[model samples]
Target: MAKKSKQYEYDLSEVKRLIGETDKNYREIAAETGCPYASVVYHGRKIRGRVNRMRQEELNIEEQQPVLSITEETTETPKMLSGGTALSISRSDVHIHDAEQEAAKMIKAARALGLNKVNITIDR
Candidate 1:
């Protein structure tokens, strides 16, 4: 008579989640979950690799799609950027996630206020 091989069900997702989200090490996770140390290490390495790939993909996407751009205002108008009054981006909530978006808004405001533009420099 032929017998089926034994199957063991283990939740590797839990280990992967801990590795990707928490600061816990593989040894700590293995100890906490009673999973084999080797299994934990293997899963941890795989999770980290996947995360790195995901981050790289995100960066590539960002690079492919420009964060900011100006399409020519397709109509007869005053010479574009035709002003002498130079204004600067001077103030805002410096701590922000999307600095480019904030700066774009500031520049748009400057243009509305009849400014060609001057400089955008940050210093410590």
Candidate 2:
């Protein structure tokens, strides 16, 4: 004949409730609640650690998102300046000296054609 092993019955809800109600260690919780010491230690630590990790992840996601503010002035399109023209070029596509050379050529041509008040804008 084979010998049968006996199982001890425990309530997980009661264990969790006790763990939440006190700052005591697993051993203290087990003694107070009449639950197994190992069960209290494992489940309590695991649940608490998981909650903490999830909170940290949420905080990280919040930090990564940019905060935007709404103001009345920013809703309207800006009006262009009168008699102003823009010459825009990318810095990576052309060097500053090369841009200066091109601007000089344009200016020389404009002056030869009797044109004045030319506006040139170079930005990175």
Candidate 3:
């Protein structure tokens, strides 16, 4: 069995500062900080959200504009399931309380289906 790697710790302040000062990509930041690329992306989003919220608060806007809006013509494509017979998932269908639970549910469902590996494609 393979050992799971530990998650890297990062200072929120530093993350905020770097995001504000530079337009570097998440992968670059991750490489420089020795953290996972996902972590870098997550932290960058968090920092951006906080900053945006602060700006909104300062502006005292009664209502905020929607970031995205769905129209009548918009169509959502059905998700496709593909791959092997032990259990691998590219995308997931189950809805759970958290991402961890969702992932577990996907794994369990794949096992139950006798799928060795599976790939899920979401057409949007």
Candidate 4:
């Protein structure tokens, strides 16, 4: 099994962009973002983590804009003696850039709710 890294409040995308677009090292980026140096390294390596909470408001506004139309349901089944049913999921408003992070959160929620199956579709 893979080890899960702790999440930080700073944005990973911003860290990645700085790493790619600037000559500054991790220490400098960490100083600028008010985040610890180790957290910067963890985000740079793309280990398991959560998106920055600092962008929550911005993400919510983006979700409100709604550029895509999603009708949200499909019945799926597999052959079994005592057939079961899959509960429907509520509408998930996911942003194009934050799909992966949003999906992670969704999966976490499902697990917390003791759900056994989960399916996520990211429409480009």
Candidate 5:
């Protein structure tokens, strides 16, 4: 007589492993793992929620730092560009230019840290 093969049920371990491996949605995980859609949805929420919580905690810690830590003052006054620039800038214009430069530096730092487009989604 021939013996029949047994089917295995989806478990938490499999779901957690898939969650850690891919950033796919619950539906996608269900299709990929051959598990039930409801099961993936249920467990995937827990996994994603944990990750989002950790991210929030880290952000909270970073927010405690002082905003205006730089206290250095420039001794020299603003001067015109050495290349004979056509645009003449006033004192207020120099302040605005300094603000723009600071913003640019912040953007460069964010991109360097791989946070150019951080999307913290915990749902489908």
Candidate 6:
């Protein structure tokens, strides 16, 4: 008589939820779930396929409805700034002292705008 491998009982819904919520790779999910990486990939793919089919059905229902038109008129006058206004300082015009001041100003501005990283590229 052949013996069956011990199966770990877990909520399939929870497994699917974790996999969808995180960007973790299959191996990471397998480690966390105590399942084989292959199984994780297989089950995850199955769950995602099912969800996609359900979404397609919902979209088909929505497509049967008539589309509504939306229009809005602007009331406020548009204001435009001319050249050499607010932070229009050119890189060529930047001296060592000016660069330091500009760097400080940029740091403050970036923090205010909640920027995580900034990339600057110079072209000749």
lDDT of candidate 5 over 37-95, digit per residue (tens) = 86776776777764444575776775565332212222444232446432222222223
Alpha carbon RMSD to native, model 6: 17.7
Report the number of the highest-TM-score candidate: 2
Residue by residue across 9-114, what tens digits does model 4's lDDT show? 8776787787667756678999888677976778655632344334645778887776542222445662222346444443455556765566676667667666
TM-scores, all models, native as reference: 0.32, 0.34, 0.32, 0.31, 0.31, 0.33
Local accuracy of candidate 6 as per-residue lDDT tens digits, 11-84: 66766776788766667778777776677778777755544445757767865664332222223332223442
Instruction: Name the weakest run of 10 consecutive residues (lDDT summed) in model 3.
Output: 65-74
- Residue ranges of candidate 2 with Cα displaced over 4 Å: 1-6, 50-124
Model 6 error, position 42 (Å): 1.1
Instruction: List lDDT for all candidates, in order.
Output: 0.62, 0.59, 0.53, 0.61, 0.53, 0.55
Q: Model 4: runs farther than 4 Å from truth?
A: 1-74, 77-87, 90-93
Question: Comparing candidate 3 with candidate 6, which one achieves the higher lDDT?
Answer: 6
- Candidate 1 lDDT over 1-124, as tens digits, reads 9999655455677777887898777778887777777788788777776444457677677666534332222233333454543344454334333666667887798678776744565433
Ten residues in a row with the worst lDDT in model 4?
78-87
Error of 3 at 86 (Å): 63
Write down the TM-score for model 2: 0.34
Pairs that collide in candidate 2 are none
- In candidate 5, which residue pairs clash? none
